[model samples]
Target: MNMSRRKFCGVGLLAVISPLGFPAFANPSARVRVGVLKFGTVNWELDTIKHHRFDAANGVDVEVVYFAGEDASNVAMLAGDLHVIVSDWLWVSRQRSEGEDLTLAPYSTAVGAIMVRQDAPIHDIPDLVGKKIGVAGGPLDKSWLLIQGLAQRDHKIDLAKEGEIVFGAPPLLSEKALSGELDAVLNFWHFCARLEANGFRRLIGAHEAAEALGASGPVSALGYVFREKWANENPDVAMGFIKASAAAKKLLADSDTEWQRLAPIVRADGRELEVLRDRYREGIPNRPLADEERDAAKLYAILADLGGERLVGKASQMAPGTFWAALKT
Candidate 1:
């Protein structure tokens, strides 16, 4: 970090150029800067991590930087203001291709679902035909692309053309779907949980779609990311963060008391609490990425086919460092 920004960029490859080794995690007291969104279930897990002192227990001091929105957090990361951020692989792959050297470590596989008002007659992909469907992340949303890919693969239907699509914010999507302005909707797990709380029903979920799409294990798309150079230099901090998060995930899974403690923060109550917890249980991956895993690769392929370079950028292949192969090591 002693070099000026221009000098750092002039070095070409993102590999660390420091002759002196970066601080090792053995010291146990150094804090790793981590960024977290202020809302959503990730916030709940992070709060658990802090409240339980998971970072200190693992011999790494984690400095949690809170961002009100994911976009602000992403901007903070790109500006080199933080060590890690939770985001999807599509952004990581696109950034890596642009010489940013970002890499991913698995977190949760929790994803969105296709939901409809309780009274709606729609039941399956075919039923979506000629109906107005509300979408949270818009046309290029990875989950939407996955369903499109699944439909094309199994039923030979193109959802992009078969349904009337409405793109809007998650809150608006929920409001419209509930008020009957939209016949159905696709929203992230958290949004879907609240929808179910309000009597909306899922027509399909990501887990089911992943299984139908031939994903080998849990279909993981989002995770924690950091610069490859920084991780290689601070090996212990990198591994400690991963190990500590895994612990928090396990705790969230096994303890009802802990779930109760986190309920208010996660915005769960009554039946919505059950819905969110079930989504959490389903999302924890059985294992991190291994050589044979193709979930991320398949998503990339689907996005490419659906949206082309405009969405995924010009990377013709999966970025080499996109999935940190070292987590399982």
Candidate 2:
């Protein structure tokens, strides 16, 4: 893949500066450690981070950590071991409330349509009444927002009520739903493609769910999160990461070939790259925070409605002292 001159310069700068020492990550030690999720759709940055033709230029050693969920990343953050966390919106909100020094760095992927078995009775959001739905990543997962968005607008079905929905991991839900153990699976990423290939039906997404709810907005998508303290202590490092990311995004925008290069790294079957790439295209746009706060608020409302408000807390509670604050700089 080709890189612009700016990207090449960024890479060179990272290499030149990495030898200098710092308390958080010392010089002449292991490469600057950065935590990354192990999901197929989420960690696509690794392709650019590791092989951006500028990896050595970034002056930081990238350490990819495969987290089972946001909670795991939180545990790692609390331990002060991981430098960054990347996942869906709800988890980010939840992490913020707990006094974790994390902030959204940049958006990665947009939440997409919910899926069900093709033979399943779930034809639309209204059909989800009394149906068991597969959910991933606990209450803070994007799937929860989709469900609430559906209930609040289309079905008028209250998510707060019991027996309205059943949530579980993709594998378990897929097994149960496919084996007649459940009615529908509300999942994301490779599972959607996998389930669809196995004859699952498309139910709804954050986008479609928003439309159904009489809203016009792109919901908060995936993002790069890191500790405020870490980022503050290493402003150059943080900026370097984002700058390189911007460069990578430019490459992606410039060529499907760039995406083709990144696809195999994140995709398990290499077929879902199209799906993943599409989500990426509609998401962050190589920038940080957007002027709009509605999507983030929508996520909070859904979490509050789902009784996860204690986990998500208020927007005011999410401080401006973190990486999100840095985005402005």
Candidate 3:
């Protein structure tokens, strides 16, 4: 699929950068240590960056560290063992409110959805009443909160009170949904894609739910999170990584061959692979940073009302500097 280069932000320099390979004599000081979840989607972009030497082209060396879980990655980042990690802006907002200097660069706008079996009686949020609904990431999950908010606003119904909500890991919820144990399931984007591949139908996507809640456009739920102090000290290296990331997104957005190359690492094949590839491409953040920030602020207000302080911490509105404006393309 051919796409306009304009869709990708901050990658104009790619035309001038040598595409052959990394420079023979590179600066050793421009190295970035990125911590990633072992099976996270972030690895797909990071892999593309490394496979195509996007980091080298942008005058930086990216060192990837794999973790079993996001909490472990967060621990490594807080311990100064890693310079960057992929996480949501909400967490960044909460951390900043607590005096942490962390900030985020927009990564993906992809979010979860409520999925039900194709033959199931569930057709809408109202249909979920008194039905067993499997929710990944627990009660305070942004996706779950958004669904609750949407349900309250549109139908005058409270899903939490009217439905049987079961919280569990994404994979487990997906399995239960497939086995008919769950009337519906809300899982992460990749898991949702897998469910879709397996003939599950989406009752409502989080993006649509956000729009119903007054979001002007697609808002990125996740980003490349890093310390403000570290970015300030290594401005060039930070900007290089951002640029490399943009270039990688551009490549992935335009190349089916690239997705095929990533088959093994993605651990998917056939219809599942195609669905995952399409969903990932759909998640590429294309709007301007200002637009994203504004929508995120609106979402923060909605999520805060539903999730309360437990999810948002001490921050009232999304803490200032939640979205790293300096990294805006």
Best-to-worst TM-score order:
3, 1, 2
Q: What total of clashing residue pairs does each candidate reach?
A: 0, 7, 0
Better of 2 and 3 by lDDT: 3
Clashing pairs in 2: 11-57, 14-57, 14-59, 32-61, 113-204, 114-204, 116-201
How high is each candidate's TM-score? 0.87, 0.73, 0.94
Using lDDT as the measure, the top candidate is 3
Residue pairs in candidate 1 whose N, alpha carbon or C atoms collide under 3 angstroms: none
lDDT of 1 by residue, 179-209 (tens): 8898889998889988988888989886677
Candidate 1, residue 127: lDDT: 90
lDDT of 2: 0.58
Local accuracy of candidate 2 as per-residue lDDT tens digits, 82-134 = 77666545566566666666676554545545677666666766676676666
lDDT of 3: 0.87
Best model number under TM-score:
3
The weakest ten consecutive residues by lDDT in model 1 span 7-16
- Point out the higher-scoring one by TM-score: 1 or 3: 3
In model 2, what lDDT does residue 238 have?
66
lDDT values for all models = 0.76, 0.58, 0.87
